[model samples]
Target: MLERFIAITADFSIIIPFIYLLFKGKIPLTISDKLIYVYIVLTLIRNIASFVTMMLGVYNIYLYNWYNLLSFGIIAALYFQILNNLYFKMLVIAALILLIAIAFIDYRTLLNVRTTEFNRFSFNASGCFTILFILFFLYELIRKLQVKKLTEYPLFWFSSGALLYYSGTIFPYIFIQYTFNNLANRDLYWIIDAVLSIVLSVFLCFSIRHMKHQKTV
Candidate 1:
């Protein structure tokens, strides 16, 4: 089915790049670098968890809550470093606290679910991150324009990736929750996630190129 194909593609699309990046000698090993490594590892783990749950024919269960916490945490850590100003740090902290509360709610919900009829867990995970990504997107775009830093390219690319992801993933996810019995449900989720993965991969590739140019200079 389309769902399975998308899942397999995402598995390879994301896992391969992270593995390559982790081992590449040319990649800088800075704080952002290490946080990125952790992010990718968490991504892989979440994917594996979803794959396992799917293979078991479960409908709503996933590893998204925990792994996504790590992903957002890593992102916040890097953003904190990038901004470095107290005002930005406070904003990031506010976002982090809100996300942590959502994650905790998700964790509690996961403990109580025992059905194959709904996939609210996925919605909660994707939707929460979608909003977070938007916040990050705005912050990155505004910060880049403010500083006039050449490194803005990476921020811009990242913001674009986040924008695409939210548009492709979050919209459908929010609506899909209302229709649990629809057989067309899974495809919607898969399609959005696939798009998100592809968009982010493109951004990461461009970021690597920019980093290489900086190194050469």
Candidate 2:
């Protein structure tokens, strides 16, 4: 109960900044801005689903896996742009397609209504690819060019949130079979994810608001 409260609070932490964006009706013309806007909507929908799923003791496994895949895919594409080199854009697109194909192949299994299990294949594959792409993105950010004040860049903050949150959760997803059956372990996983989410929400808020000042200027 307490952990759920913590998680909900952490999740809603972005609402203020999101509402600000809604009212202002403007943001810096950047991929990061678009991604954050979509993310805000998705988070709201996911939270509602989470509430319903919790009370009913039913899991929407399809939404869970697909949302992960979609979120990672979007961020992956955004990072490619942020890296400012379209050299491997074709390869990235191919990889994303393959990721989708892989998920589709396992759709029936993943969507099994009777089984109270998650589709680790989609979850871990998406995580691994996203993490790899992000690592390369970071390398590019540092090596290809040196921006004077990267800290102010929205992508910098967005990537920080994604990198930190995903890195922490991806490993657990890889080894999910070990802890999925244990109530206490599952709760621990939720708590860890929730804490990371708090960090991410803060960074996301900053990522969006940094533009408000730019808007004024």
Backbone clash count, each prediction separately: 0, 0
Candidate 1 wrongly placed segments (more than 4 Å): 56-60, 112-156, 179-184, 212-217
* Tens-digit lDDT string for candidate 2 (105-187): 76774566544455646677777777777777777767755655667766667778878888888887787666543545777
- Tell me the alpha-carbon RMSD of every candidate: 4.5, 3.5
Q: For each candidate, what is the lDDT?
A: 0.59, 0.69
Off by over 4 Å in 2: 109-115, 181-184, 212-217
Q: For residues 28-59, what per-residue lDDT tens digits would candidate 1 score against the true structure?
A: 55555555556666777777767777778764
Q: Pick by TM-score: which candidate is best?
A: 2
Clashing pairs in 1: none
Judged by lDDT against the true structure, how good is candidate 1?
0.59
lDDT of 2 at 57: 88
Report how far residue 206 has shifted in candidate 2, in Å: 1.2
